[model samples]
Target: MTDVVGIVIVSHSPLVAEGAADMVRQMVGDRVPLAWCGGVGEGVLGTRLSDIRAAIDRAWSERGVVVMVDLGGAETNSEMAIEALPPERRRKVVVANAPVVEGAVLAATEAASGAALATVLATAEEAGARCRSVPSKTSAGRRQ
Candidate 1:
């Protein structure tokens, strides 16, 4: 079986993490294993540090996991969670490059079986930059 790619998005708002998952679902469907962390909403992604860490462990146990954070605070929490895991688990847990929405998707998608987390993270960073370059549609384009 193809190795699963675990994902975690940490942001100031949990919605951002959840939204990333929603977008991924729309683009790639849920065939690949995915997870989320951080968010203020009730049902939005894993909230507590322990939950995030557990998800990472679970995902990694199945295959491996990549964690992406939107900002310093989120990154700190995510990092702490990962650090708290057992040494063996740390090998499976990756602190993703630029840990943003765009990066997470790109990394997760590009990652094949047992690929190094750093490689996927690099792809994510590059993809995020590319995504930023895309122009958004203006209100004038559609009748509202």
Candidate 2:
């Protein structure tokens, strides 16, 4: 494992997860260990404990891993997967309570900077607030 923290993206749709992972890759490059899992199989839309566990393993690092999930079921399965890991390994994993795509990108960016696991997770969790704070254009085309 690298010195940087790792990241895992989980989503109900395979395309969503892959798209997020691709964004992270484009932004952070390979400086951080990254992995993603979504959908059960054969074009199905669901998460599997085994797949999540495998992604975690693939993204494992001594610095730790932060998992970003798109929905409740993904979060549940990710939690179960973390719990199933050996105690030592499990302690280093956490599920980030942030928007899946944005969180994964931000988390990976932080991790690629060699930030600690806690810092990376915090960055991911803060994504929602950051998004909320952004100025948006109103229907009239004025910033709102």
Best by lDDT: 2
lDDT of 2 by residue, 27-143 (tens): 879888999999878888888899999999899899999999876678778899999999999999999978888889899989988999999999998886776654221123211
Report lDDT (Cα) of residue 15, candidate 1: 74
lDDT by residue (84-125, candidate 1, tens digit) is 988877777777645376776676676643455566667777
Clashes of each: 1, 0
Weakest 10 consecutive residues of candidate 2 by summed lDDT? 135-144
Model 1 worst lDDT window (10 residues):
135-144
- Clash pairs for candidate 1: 14-39
Tell me the lDDT of candidate 1: 0.63
The TM-score measured for candidate 2 stands at 0.89
The alpha-carbon deviation from the true structure for residue 23 of candidate 1, after best TM-score superposition, in angstroms, is 1.0
